[model samples]
Target: MAWAILFLAGLCEVAWAVGLKFSEGFTKLLPSVFTVGFMLLSFWLLGLALRNLPLGTAYGVWVGIGAIGTAIAGIYLFDEPATLLKSVSLLLIVAGIAGLKLSSH
Candidate 1:
């Protein structure tokens, strides 16, 4: 399904984002390779999803997934503060994503 593909693409976006952090400006060979590979795969999946899904909804959901995943990963992996404000903001993002999905019907 296009939705599944789009969600997978969003996960790949999160992978590439983490890879980029480990890449250290692309100086790290393995991380750089991982980042590049995932980047390509993410875009490829996104393009496939675009065949049937509306661009605004697909892109919005994709971005929302990446944003939420990256923020959580940053907190756990990089010791970023998980403050109440930040947590609430993330919840709001999730709510918006949910609203978008629900309204698409």
Candidate 2:
């Protein structure tokens, strides 16, 4: 359950990140509002998960998920480069996250 909440928090992290881009320097009202809303929600859930999870592992996993999700979203939404190197790097991040998860027990 904690992992599930953490994963959703990670998704919210992605939401706010993309929201930051769409918010257009906070000039756009709706996206800006959403960006701020999701940011708080993300932090709330992260804090909840941290109560039960190890600080280093939870924070690293949260960041790893956010980084990978945002990079993928950027590729599709912003036409960012989709080079082989980028793909390999993302896989490495996933591997690290998995390693952390497996070692957490």
Candidate 3:
């Protein structure tokens, strides 16, 4: 299904985002390669999903997923601050993504 592909793409977005931290400005060879690979795969999946999903809905959901996932990764992996406001904001993004999916045909 297109939604499933889109969801996978969103997950890839998260992987690549975390990969960037590991890549260290692309100075690390293995991590940089994996990051680039994930980036390409994520875009490719998005393209496939676009065949059936609306651009606005797909893009918004993809971005929301990446944002939320990366933020969580940062909090857990990098000791990034996890304030109350940040948590609430992430929840809001999740709600928006759910609303978008429900509203889409």
Candidate 4:
């Protein structure tokens, strides 16, 4: 199903994001390779999802989900900024994604 593929793509997005952090400016071999693979897989699934979902809606949701997911991972796993302001911003992104899904129906 397209939804399942999209969800997988989102997970890959998260993986690649963590990969990027470990990439050490792409000098690290394993993480760099994994990052490339995950990035390719994520985009491929996004393209497949776009075959049925509207481009504007699908792209927006895909990007929003990836951004929010990656930001949360960065904060919790990487000790990046986790301020209340960042939390509010992430919630806003989630709210927007929810709104998009609701309006699509």
Largest lDDT belongs to which candidate? 3
Model 2: weakest 10-residue lDDT segment is 1-10
User: Model 2, 9-98: lDDT tens per residue?
Assistant: 999999999999999999999999999999999999999999888989999999999999999999999999999999999999999999
Candidate with the larger lDDT of 2 and 3: 3
Better of 2 and 4 by lDDT: 2
lDDT of 4: 0.87
Off by over 4 Å in 1: none
For each candidate, the alpha-carbon lDDT, in order, equals: 0.94, 0.95, 0.97, 0.87
Number of residue pairs clashing in candidate 4, backbone atoms closer than 3 angstroms, sequence gap of 3 or more or interchain:
0
Structure candidate 1, residue pairs in collision: none
Sorted on TM-score, best first, the list reads 2, 3, 1, 4
* Tens-digit lDDT track of model 4 for 1-105: 776777677778888988999998899999999999999999999999888777777887888878988998998888997999999999999999888777777
lDDT score, candidate 1: 0.94
lDDT of prediction 3: 0.97
Off by over 4 Å in 4: none
- Overall local distance difference test of candidate 2: 0.95
Each prediction's TM-score versus the true structure: 0.96, 0.98, 0.97, 0.93
Q: What RMSD does each model have against the real structure?
A: 0.8, 0.6, 0.6, 1.1
User: Which 10-residue window of candidate 4 scores lowest in summed lDDT?
Assistant: 1-10
Q: Write the per-residue lDDT of candidate 1 for residues 35-73, one digit (tens) a residue.
A: 999999999999999998888988999999999999999
Off by over 4 Å in 3: none
